[model samples]
Target: MSTYNNQETQEIPLVKKFPKLKVLPHVNLINSPTPVEKMMRSSEILGGMNIWIKRDDLTNSKYGGNKLRKYEFVFPHIQKKNKKRILTVGGLGTNHGLANVIIANDFGIKTSLFLVDQPLTHHVRENLLCDYYYGADLNYSKDTKGAVYHILKDLVTDWSSYYLCVGASNSVGTIGFINAGLELAEQIKKGDIPEPDKIFIAVGSMGTVLGLFIGLELAGLKTKIMGISVLDENLNSTKKLQKLIRKTMNRLRKIDKSIPDVSKKLFERFSMNRSFFGGEYGRYTYEGLEAIEIARNDGIELDPVYTGKTFSALVDFCRNNPNAKNETILYWHSKSSVDLSSIYNNVNYKDLPKEFHQFFDGTVEIDDKAVHCIRKKKN
Candidate 1:
């Protein structure tokens, strides 16, 4: 709701490096140059590296996160094409779908969210309410098969709609994070934080990781991308990352030929750690909860679904790596920092469809011990 979220985009960093990138439509969904600061207590507690955080969580006042960055490029382009509606897919409590609805609604464009099932938690339930609160047409897809049928049906039924893949991982939306990488480079030049030897972040749909990877590459930074896989291997593989990197890089090239191919070196600079994933999407792990508790002491809130698992990997790296204490580390806090207490309290779960009631009514049992604790607290 801040005035800056709607402000005009004069010259983003991506365009600064390659002027031709200005051809792609962009709208400001984030309060850019999001703060970077050292995690002093976290550093001392880990007894390792001087850990720093890129506060991307504060990207917007309404609903900040890495998702907003993607929408910055996506929403404006949707408007340019005169799309009347957006159809997207995600888990039943996907922050990505909720973000899509909230920001797309601001543009007066309707959103239809086709949701598949994931392990339920209070965070997921609140996100579902926000999706409905923001005027999204919601469908409770029991699984991917159901989601596909509904999406296919909707596409045929709704001709004026534009469909975006999960997490907006396609070439266009991916550009926003590329811009994010460049944004980080600019911050480094300004001495906001030291050049990180490694950056830790969550990898779900893979757009964020690929974008940052390419963006850092484009910025000529030597920072390695340590992606924590929050999903199954089939969805978060290096091969899939490469494919999207290829698509996003090629898209940038079409706009500016001066942009170099960073894909060749991506393998050397990128590593995916799947140990913290705890076997499935949305399932919180023991390590993730410990990470959440550690981050909270530093005044940072990370979700069990994404950032918690991510920071856990970062924590483990600091504790386990022999060179960790000698290197400068960065944790890209990608989850939204918004306090949705009022929003969750104001919206009633009964307002959602009959099939959706189970998530809130406690019929859907939480499979993870860490997630179950939060479910009891209802935070």
Candidate 2:
């Protein structure tokens, strides 16, 4: 609920360098400089390691999540161009897709999503219903080629539409997370939390970690970043992040050519851990569920898809590395903290696209882990 104070906000060099980033059209969706708090209970249970959480979950009450941070930047860019429609892509239960639908509605811009298949868990079912409730146009794609074709066709035919890369991972959206890094830097300065020895975050499309890496490095913090890959193991999270970082740097350079160039040394500070993936993207893992339960002890609600798996990695890392007991660790809570039961309850499944109704009707069989958690909650 607190906006970042002037001193801390002013200290962000990226904001200073790209003055337009401040003046540009933007919707104030997130309650910026979201509070940083120590996870006292979780820390105690884990044997006294300093652990903390950056509550990006409480970014906004209406539809809070890390994607809103990206939209804070992307939405304005689209507005400046006078675009009326946004075309984006993601999976069936994409946090980004639902976020885009909700936030874009604020600006009167319609959202069209090209979603690929994923395990039909309750989360996926809920998002599909909410997407329609929020007035998004949806097209289900069977494969990557189909998704690409949908995007290309939209671009070719729709002059009023703007394409947002999956999860809005473009340079513009990535800037939001860079700002997040600055916000964290300011928090560290104010003694809200110590400069973490390592930061654990879920990495799906690479924007969140990429921005944190750039922001933390620019802020003169050498904290190592551990990204838990929630996507497929076959996907190269590190290489994908490197490419995004390079692209983001190129974008920044264009804004202020005098900005210093990034070097290979920065890459050394980052490493990806894939042990928690638990197979494909949407399926749940047992450790993720356990991590969710563990976090719940401290009153944190972590979704099984992303934050749960990332925290599971955090848990495993702490347990395995006994030396890390005293080292400061931070978990970036990326999932939306707000409960969606009320919204989902009110949605009429029949109103959703017919294809998506199968998820709610039990016609689609998916991995049991995600379903187990959902059913357990209901029972």
Candidate 3:
């Protein structure tokens, strides 16, 4: 297998020296060279075509996930703008918000989060408590997705600090995954990974998928990338992804007017298949639960909200696509370890619904040695 360095050297231009590239200063938050592991069991289960995983979950940084990669391209702009605080919008258990809080703290930037009261699983407790422990100013509203725009608009009146949009929807944030696509392409050329027929990833806000689309086009790779939607909005995720791609391409065109207009073709080249969303946002299905168990048994971790559904879709797709059986597939596992200590402090366990009681029942015990009055529940 071939290896490539994922480090961003100082010699590299602030915005990557591409003539059409829009440069933005961003703090480096994720560790470089996350390992790519081939999934043997998953491959066998799907009749063995070669299934692989990109271990973004193992990113050496304390806050790991696909978000950190996006932040690498975001935080620098935040720093350059001299923004003291970041305001973002997400649901109650927002992995994006949690990652922002951790990275912002590292850079000494305060963060305010607007959390919508969306329907979520009772047992899941990853993003909410992490946000609290990281000391993000939290606000809650039962705002539908449309209301989020107005909420942010209203917030600007109350607070003058710059707002960090979730997924960093602009060109700056998209660069992170564009760079990842470049890195993945180089790996393929070096024979580190077999040429994948398909790549599956979860799509929430569209930055990562758009970045991947741009990067693959730039790298001239033919792999088909699919985005599984976790939210149940009627709008197509591909359309949202295309909009971001157009915005990035437009920004690039401004930097170097000489670049060809490939925006229309780029949209056609990047395909997003979203037949996996069962129903509603933040809700789990039986397939998702089965995928979660299979993943855990395979020694990989996934949450039901995002990666679980994406991986489940990938498995089902592989099983259904008879023509694709001969080619390799890739599933992007994009979750990180939960910090139980901080979760205990922020979430009231008693408030959880009874159906989810088993998840936190004896699994999370308070440490008597830590001097906090928190006590472990007797099993």
Candidate 4:
């Protein structure tokens, strides 16, 4: 493994700590120990609590986000199995698909994206163009089930291909966040940030938060995790997350037979907040836009769909719990901070796939029911 900042190649501490766990050979895909900086201005604005931000946004220069952490574990497993192509699924504007294509290209691995329709936003269009520009074979399906069928067919016909699910949420991919939890523990020991009383993270596919919960358990940190759901509100359950975490722990147990069993006590370490989802997954909210404006004051960029909603929750928590001013709070900033306007500027949307051109041309209108609770009133 390696990090861009220090240029050091060392075994990840998680593997060193639990030698019995089986791990694939790793390649350094990110700059390790992404800075843990205190949100001094936001802290002052939000009732004087000790607020901090973990900048997963700067995971890399071109592509960065919480997804890169998962790719660290996922790409290696693909290589070890000698897979020539990676087949994955997501919505038309998925950051996961874009991130997968960008990083997989570094290792000379081909990626195929099977996607369904999503609301048209600049972010979604940029991702679609980049997916093509980055040389991913693209397949647009009517819905998710169609995409799944296509992936299964590809796996059977093209034996060299591997079908990794959306956001790489499986057990193996979840290891990256386990490493992240340990990384934070080291930063705390070094006094980069105070031991947080609560940690806030956006939850979509659930691997990121699930891994962090498991990692904190392994690292022996008692910080409570506040997983803000970016998808369905019903997913904010200990029951749902525990299923994924148990599967991940079972995978780790393959390396050592003596790992602790799952219990209700372990589940108590995390809580879910689902009030910020707005409406459907891709819809922007009134509060989410306000959050972007607030973070901009602090010189932090938050995209409307994910991190904005997550931060809104963090902000709301502070407002509602005015008495908890002295407690430390951490927000895991998972969205990419890098700007892609240059890449978006160079590409003509009409040159891309025919089905995607409608999004740019304005012929295919967005469904009115798709968006909700915006401050801007639509006629």
lDDT per residue (tens digit) for residues 160-209 in model 3: 46677765666778878877777677678778888777889988787877
Query: Between 2 and 3, whose lDDT is larger?
Result: 2
User: Among these predicted structures, which one has the highest TM-score?
Assistant: 1
lDDT of 1 by residue, 1-379 (tens): 2132433465788888887777788887788889999998899899856999999999988889999889888888888888889988999889999888888777888988889988777788789888888888988888888887888888798788888888998888898898999999999999888999999999999989888988898898999999988887887677787788888888888877878888898888888877777777888788889999998878999999899989988888888888899999999999998887788889998998788888888788855565432232232
Error of 1 at 273 (Å): 1.2
Per-residue lDDT of 1-379 in model 4, one digit per residue for the tens?
2222212225565665676553445556777789998888888887687888999999988799999888877887887888989999988888999999888887778999998877667778888888888888888886888998899899999989999988899888888898899889888989988888899999888899888988888888889999888776453455666777788888887777776644344558887766787757778887787778878877899987889889888888898896658788998999887787777778888777787788778887654233443332221
lDDT of each: 0.85, 0.80, 0.67, 0.80
Q: Better model by TM-score, 1 or 2?
A: 1
Candidate 1 wrong stretches, greater than 4 Å: 1-10, 370-379
Which ten-residue region of model 1 has the weakest summed lDDT?
Answer: 370-379
Which residue pairs collide in model 3, if any?
A: 25-76, 25-77, 26-76, 27-76
Clashes of each: 0, 0, 4, 0
Q: Give TM per candidate.
A: 0.94, 0.91, 0.81, 0.91
Off by over 4 Å in 2: 1-13, 16-27, 233-237, 370-379
User: Where in model 3 is the C-alpha error above 4 Å?
Assistant: 1-23, 122-124, 145-155, 158-160, 234-239, 256-261, 338-379
lDDT at 188, model 2: 90
